[model samples]
Target: MRNEKMNTNPDAVRQPLLQVSNLAVDFGTVDGVVHAVEGVDLESAPGETVAIVGESGSGKSTTAMAVIGLLASGGRVAGGSITLDGRELVGISENEMRRIRGRDIGMVPQDPMSNLNPVAKIGTQVAETLLAHGLANRSTVQQKVIEALSAAGLPDPERRAKQYPHELSGGLRQRALIAIGLACRPRLLIADEPTSALDVTVQQTILDQLDEMTRELGTAVLLITHDLGLAAERAQRVAVMHRGRVVEQGPARQILEDPQHPYTQSLVQAAPSIAAARLQPEVFQTGREQDAAADAVADNIVEIEGLRKVYPMRGSASDFVAVDDVSLAIPRGKTVAIVGESGSGKTTTARMLLKLIEPTAGTIRFEGNDIAKLDRAQSREFRQRVQPVFQDPYSSLNPMFTIERLIAEPLEFYKRGSRAERRSRVRTLLDDVALPQSMLQRYPSELSGGQRQRVAIARALALSPDLIVCDEPVSALDVLVQDQILTLLGDLQKEYGLSYLFISHDLAVVRLISDYVCVMKDGALVEAASSEEIFTNPRDPYTRRLLASIPGNELGIAS
Candidate 1:
């Protein structure tokens, strides 16, 4: 109930850094007019961090783009006013907007890979922003770039500046983007899902850096994200958006503790840390039952013994051991979560399990058959039983195919049924994933991130396979939608008795769905234990560190 008025003066009343009111945007296309944003009102006072929370297509990103005057071609700002320090921005010519952008307001886009030019060196990109804003000359830009990288928490900034975008990790690339945004010392910084692609540790580091930089520079921030936990952790105020409108806005504590809207409530409740809210004694009793069942059925649906994968170093003294002597068993109808940092061999293990690459040494067994020895025909059959849901939904589904076609491809390739039966099956799968039947004809480009992921899940289930390797399936989804998907997976497991080898770095999520947990570090399994055991009494220091890294754990939010 903090009613802070938006400051209208550019130099008086400590001046609100940015003000946006009744904004609307539309994209005219061949099919129809796409209403991207509508009637959105937001503001950020000097040195305040405000978070915009919503599911995809809720106008969060579009609103930010509109404020910065960066909407794509054919995308028109249909209505509203945007003022940066009382300077009108809506309807301003591109040339005027260009002069304002990067100098007064800066943006950090979602995907680092696509946002940073692949061909440009990291230092040059940051320095170019400074030069364009007339902040520094070519000679001084290099020094400024290094300082900016260092300020962004990138290690060895001097060397990192010389490297291209591809050379840095996902976390580093995101930091590089931030460095470029902060290079000019803009009064307002807009970050759109900056940590969506990073692992948990890297994400924590980046967020911490943002908080520190904001405090130091006294910069106003507009953070756009689907992760409510992150918003609660970083922002002072939260705005909840849905269906192209802001449904609720309040202080961060009020929104997190007592959400006024049902959507906001569901978002907080759906968080894995919050969902696992029962008493410790109750969870322990459930764990006992799980332990007994695990002992009764110890047979492996998929097993990897002494697996090793090596990548030859380019003109180096030694090769890299991506997966070193990794051994594990995935039991039927059970969920095994593999938790690790980036480059810790989690994805490599998944790739090896899929037989995408032959292991350097060891055996992989699928239902008692050695998949490593399988021929082309046998490998195709194996693919049917073990399907994968990739991390990025945007790239996983084809842009040209309709939802029905995408889901039906697996069934058609396997020749499971007649054309009529296949169509019925596709409809059923879509329904199972809680998608509308009207979405059948829409392509991947038409759907939101969560919807596209649901379609991917529907396709994965089309095969009716025994095992599914979900690779960070819910990482890209909003909290509320993620809960629905996790609940759907649980229901599907009960119905079909399917087995899953879930991989993720989100410890809270791993605790929610996994029966067992395997901790990996440096391409090796550091520890393996039941979920309850792992949470209650972690024997390894690394495991404890990972658990400590989870936000809200120390604050009793997990309760």
Candidate 2:
């Protein structure tokens, strides 16, 4: 938070660096004309951050794309004007827009994998921005790219420059995008959900870097995000949109603390950062059912001891220890979460527990039987009892299949029912996940991101596994939708005596669902305790650092 906030002050007068007046954008679709954005009026003065907060398909990203004249096929601006530094942008020629793109305006798109060229090295991409804008020559561009990458908080920039997008981690890829976006030193920057794909700590670091870079260059920022609390914490002014229109706009903190629109109120209320506690049992099903489930939990369903995983190094006598001697217990019908950063071996530990990978030295006991010694028939049964729900719902599912077939695949493979019975079970699973029956016929691409995640959860439930391994399940979702999915998981846990080995980097989400917590760093458990103890009185310094990185920690919002 800066001492002098941006986009606020009635007395001060200055020309807006970027002004969007009555911006109406539409797409010619097969069904009809899709009114993506209509009559949207907003402005960002120099060094200001005006965040457009809304859910997916609320026209937030579309508005940014249209302003930059990079609208996808079949998309066009129907009415209104978008001006940058008093220059009209809507009716400009493609060549003119290209000239204006890297020189006058820069964009940081949401997905780094799709945004960054996979074939090229990261340094070359950043150098292209500088070279295209005539900001640097071939000789100076390499040094400039390294500086940009270092400024974006990427470690070992010189080595990272030679690597491609697929070789880098998610956070590093995002930093690469930031390096490209800010390389030209543009007057205006449009960041479209720039931090959505990162972890909490990485997200905070990227945002702090972006804020510093834009402030140093005096760049006006048009930030479009779905997290209202994040918008309040980062932006000086907030604009709320629903159904392709700006419903409310005002100072950031004021808008969040005292929202005028009903839609904004719903957003604020549904935010998990605001509601720091678990969802009410009544919100799920009934208090009595939840109480009964709590009363019935008495035994440990899965127990691990001395878990150690070592990857043999290539051309070396040493082995890379991915997981140290770690031990934990998951109580029946309780969720135990493992939290850490990338390369901390959280995913490796989860994979070992799921029996997808073998551990060097470990005793994994499920109901008092060692999993390592499971016979052929028992291994098949273990697969039925334990299921995994991975992150990246987009790629986790088979896009070629319909929603109904996707859900029924698990049941069909497990031989749970006949064709008719499996279809009936698919309908029930959809209801359990709170999705629509009509969605069964739809493909994964046809549904929104949130809808696709819900479908993935439905498919996970088709087999009714005893234990579910959820790895960063809702990390890609918006605040509103993340809360919904967490509540849905809580309700499902109550209904079934299910246990969860939840793996996540988000401590806020872990606090809402997990009964116990384990913090891992560099392949070793630094601290382990109950959820409340871990959050309130963490004994380890690393745990404290992780809690400090949470965004929206200072926002004033009600439960």
Candidate 3:
């Protein structure tokens, strides 16, 4: 439970913290003048949170960037007035903005991995903020850095400070970003999708930390996110953006319960968390939904026993066990999701199941065949039987290749058909994923985040594999696009009788898509049960805490 309450004092705020009126921003691109934001009006008071919700390319991030005076080249304020406590910031000089940035305004950018320098130590990054702002002298900077990390919920800040960005888990990296954002205790904090990359438990911890700190410091938060549930739960006021304009703005509860705009209504109804079709067997299953209990365990498509993976320490004789005696079963044509923190071995188990990584001790039976004992020819065939959709689509996709080539490469690798035939298969996969055939000629950089993920899914399905391992497929997408991808996967599963070994940290998404749920922690399975049992009545303490951590779990909103 939270030790303190924040977002609890609306009446205490009398003075306006940030005010933006009739804001308009545009980018001069090679295509032409692109109007990113138009006629936007928003305000936030001290000790308050104003959430701006929208899908990607809906001007939410652009508005925040314009307010922060960090808009990239070719982008300028076409029309608008941005003021902080009566001080104009839109036309401010860079040097002046730099002084105001950390001292008066702090920001937590969306992408933690790219925002952080790969070569620098995390401690140095945190200390640099305090030193640059003249908040602390060199003598006390190290201690201040450790304190910031500790406050951000990172355990053993002393050791964590020396590690680089790659050495930490995704959750730790996000918390590091948070520590940097709040190191100066700025009057205004611009947080853009702060918890979008973290697991549920870690997301709650980070949000709680932010709420407490902001409340204590009287900092106004301008949150830019696509999660309607998060806005409904944490924000004092909600602003919904459609296309390039704000269509609705009001109290959080009022906006979520009774949205006035059609765009807002569509967003709420399309979200997977609202109805949770995955936990309901009747909705997720086919005609045999009622007979699931009567089905035998032998109906599983993949079975594992005593799975263990150990990696040797750098210099020590000891070894690190990533997956410890983990066992699970994936029923034929059923979706079983594994949920856990980043390093909890969910990905490791999935990798082993796909034979991408070998297990030190265990037996993985795929269709009653031991994957470990497969010969060269059999292994080659196994590659065609199983496919994987990685977590990061941009990294997974090759920038040099067009979307068509990326999808056709798998078909060509397996020698499934001729050049013309492989081209036909790629088109069919594009149609199945709801992508236009015209997009085949474009490179990965030309597509948006959601479109790139869709292309990745199309590539994964090019082989028509019997089992597909989707690792955090929809974590980076907005709720509307996430729902579309989920629906596509479900439809494909039913049409092709495909089985899925889904791995994700988002429990709300897990509950919405999985027939069975497996909870993992510290490289072990803490609990495994049907989706309904896990969501409705989790037995394990860890599982219960996880259930309690879903964003907006405590709120009750009307339809």
Candidate 4:
């Protein structure tokens, strides 16, 4: 553990470079004015990192956006004092703030897909930042852009620079954002869940590089993340936020190890850690019923043998093998997790199982029948029985549809019941996912990330699917919401005898939910075992390295 101490004394001679006092932010919505952040006090010295940890709606990101003077439309500071090098920023003009944005205070926003310009080349974006900040001119911008991308740890910088944001992988897009944020070497950096899209090993590498770069420049970092372990590992101080207020703020170790606020304590409890045991649902705790149910089926529900997917390159004879000889099985009413880094073929394998894409070579059998061999009617039945809960709920759900329509779409699609019955089924699903009936008329945009996810789950369960392919279902959610979603899945599994083919880069999350684990690297399965055996005694070096990359693994925090 790092032995750094926070300077908390009010009478101290040294002053913070970035100071936030009594900050409040409000958003004007259709309902009325909503206070998104209130009375939040935080500060960070040069060469220091301070993290704000909270749930999805806790206003951590709002506070960071406030600091950068980039609040969304309909949002206003309301009341606050934000000082950068003793200069007040609240009343500054947009032009002045623009000047300060890239040169003085950099921002690495979440959601690289939305943040990065789809039409712009990667090099153009980085160059724009450099040129706008007067760090480089037109003549020198290209080299500087490549240098920045290289600094952000992007491989093949020259080729990557020429590609558009859409052409790069999620991890690459995130790195490009990081490159832009750190291009000018700003005095202060606001990282709003900057590494959320990255894999654990890449996350560690990026954070390490960020640490080194910021240290050299004496930059202050205001990190907003839902990840408690990452906050504890990377930041010197941690602030606990709840319902737009800073409930507690102190040294990282003190806040996480001995959380004072009730909200903070709940966050610690809900956060999935490597030290935590596999969470058992109420039904599973008493193994008698579950054991008997498992015995009755006595066979795997889905099996993959020599599954391989190859993408032909545009101009080359060689093809890209996304999933190479991936073989795994999902038992009835059990979770079989595929854990790997980005581009390691976890999602590819899941897509194959879903029949979204065909395999170049291999077999995917569902209930002793090859999915590829299914006829039209059989395929329709298979589609009803096998469903998917995607990673980003906001993207997955149709914004035009109400919660009722979204959940009941599948029921209506297969014409399972009358309109009244489908609506009734939607209500039942809402209860199954622990959502209120009042949400039926609400749009997807009106709900929080967790609520949106519940709705997605409800939609998946609309047809009473035997198997649900959950592709990083809870990765975008906060700790509390992640725990809730996992619990709901477990309960639903027990009740409906549902099987799960789970995919995630989060090892801790995988540890909590998975029954069996398969580790993949470079499009190949490196290791497979029971959850207990895999985590307790990983056989492969790649698996061990993945485990070791988990943030705060060294702290040994009690789960």
RMSD, candidate 3, Å: 2.8
Error of 2 at 28 (Å): 1.0
Q: What is the lDDT of residue 435 in candidate 3?
A: 93
Candidate 3 local lDDT, 355-453, one digit each (tens): 888999989999889999999999998888899998778989999999999999998888899899999999999999899999999999999888898
In model 2, which regions exceed 4 Å deviation?
1-13, 280-298, 311-321, 556-559
Model 2 / residue 134 / CA error / Å: 2.4
Question: Stretches of candidate 4 above 4 Å error?
Answer: 2-13, 281-298, 557-559
Tens digit of per-residue lDDT, candidate 2, span 404-447: 99999988887998899999999999999999899999899999
Query: What is each predicted model's overall lDDT from 0 to 1?
Result: 0.82, 0.83, 0.85, 0.88
Instruction: List CA RMSD, all candidates.
Output: 4.1, 4.1, 2.8, 3.4
List pairs with backbone clashes in candidate 4: none
Per-candidate TM-score against the hidden true structure: 0.89, 0.92, 0.95, 0.95
| Candidate 3 error regions (>4 Å) | 1-14, 279-297, 315-318, 555-559
Would you list the rank order by lDDT, best first? Answer: 4, 3, 2, 1
